[model samples]
Target: MVSTGLEDLEQSFSSQIRNGWNARPVFVPAEFAGMRGRLGVHDVVMTVERSTGRGFESITVASIQTDEGTGRGDAATSTAEAPHDRVSLTVIGLPELGSPLPIIGIDMIALKGTLSLVALDLAPTSTSFWDDVCEKRLFALAEDARDRLVIRKRPEFAHETFSRHAIIAAARPGCEEHAFAIARNFFTLATDVVAAAMGRVGDDPIEARNRNLAWRRSERQNRKEMNALARMFGEDRARTFIDAFLFA
Candidate 1:
């Protein structure tokens, strides 16, 4: 297996989540761990990790890497001149049953030699949370990243799922470091949001839960991602994994 530099970045983000949240492993099926197999003419590797902490309901990170690489087919998502070899996706799900905090998400795709895309967001559950908890810090980070990188348009569902301050951008050859820093900064800010939500009162729990459910429904409707996963894995497995790890 070759390194697309995503491995290190994924490790860094996972470590931060573990330490900052005092997270403990959530049960994962054996098949989702250290899985190696063949997909078409290319060898494939994939992993899924899930954890839960005091204030968080669940946190999930998953990665998919293909030897021959794959194109996302959206130029806005990937400005790389070539296909990408690895993708790292993370979602830090807040406890929607209690707190109306935003869900933190980051997705990164790396070409064979360089980064192609980095999309980071604190997906808001309510307008008040967006304004009070996320607006200022998130926009500051987004603006800084935007100043250095080429901003990309979100997919249709993402436009509905992500907050206004979401940073969806492509980091060209020389801008990988800036993109990584922005991702890290967003993760840090997300942890701070979690800390602030501890013991903090929120709006109606029923409303918060319903909003999060709506967000997950929209996210799961992403056809491109679902189609790609179905192609590599079976449709049933893909759907199961999506429901279990990616959005659950």
Candidate 2:
């Protein structure tokens, strides 16, 4: 189903998150269901899925597809060949408070037939959370991509939130596959981290919660993202979506 390079990466990421993590589908609220018609853009689609599993407290995978009329449409569209300017996939995995696992965050964007952006990070949710092995693997994967792809400078807010080795790239003409490789490898490493966190404990819940709150606070400050959502879904719905789905 995923023959195109960008589509292949999106499908691979979704499949890995669902099957590799044994994450099941959960209910999406009715209000968030009929979003296609709400937005007048052609084939505007927004899908949000929230699930929780053994080692995770909450796992969210959402996507949006739309033409250039609306801003920041996620790649959750069903038909990749359809007339659309952008498609994006966002994944956020929050480990259980006791697991001591870093949060898994990925945002992939495909625009005008090219894989434009690939943002992947394993963000720590606690003051004292650190994994030397994981950091080494992340840095290695990120550096390889950096050498081959066009790295994008992160926003000021993201600097403190995302890991030092996070891969934020703007894949130029022939670098889509290279970008895909880094993302795939990072995802694989994320699964390995989840597996390792299964029986681990002793993380401070208070510290984790504080870090998560701070991350969300910083994320809310992204005017570009908020403005895009507001233009696409309206001010009220965009706010609600951000609170309920995006950063919740």
Off by over 4 Å in 1: 1-5, 37-41, 66-87, 111-113
Compose the digit string of candidate 2's lDDT tens values, residues 3-39: 2554566577667767887877677787775455233
Top-lDDT structure, candidate number:
1
Q: Which stretches of candidate 2 lie over 4 Å from their true place?
A: 1-3, 37-41, 67-81, 84-86, 126-129
The 10-residue segment with the lowest total lDDT in model 1: 75-84
Instruction: Give the Cα error of residue 206 in candidate 2, in Å.
Output: 2.8
TM-score of each: 0.82, 0.82
Per-residue lDDT value at 100 in model 2 = 65
- For candidate 2, the TM-score is 0.82
RMSD of 1: 5.1
Clashing pairs in 1: none
Residue 86, candidate 2: Cα error in Å is: 6.2
- Compose the digit string of candidate 1's lDDT tens values, residues 1-248: 12345666678778877887788888878876655544444556677788887556778788776644544455423322333355545454655454677777777765334555678888777567668888999999989987988888778987666888888898877668777777777878887888877777666667667777777887788786777667777787778777776676
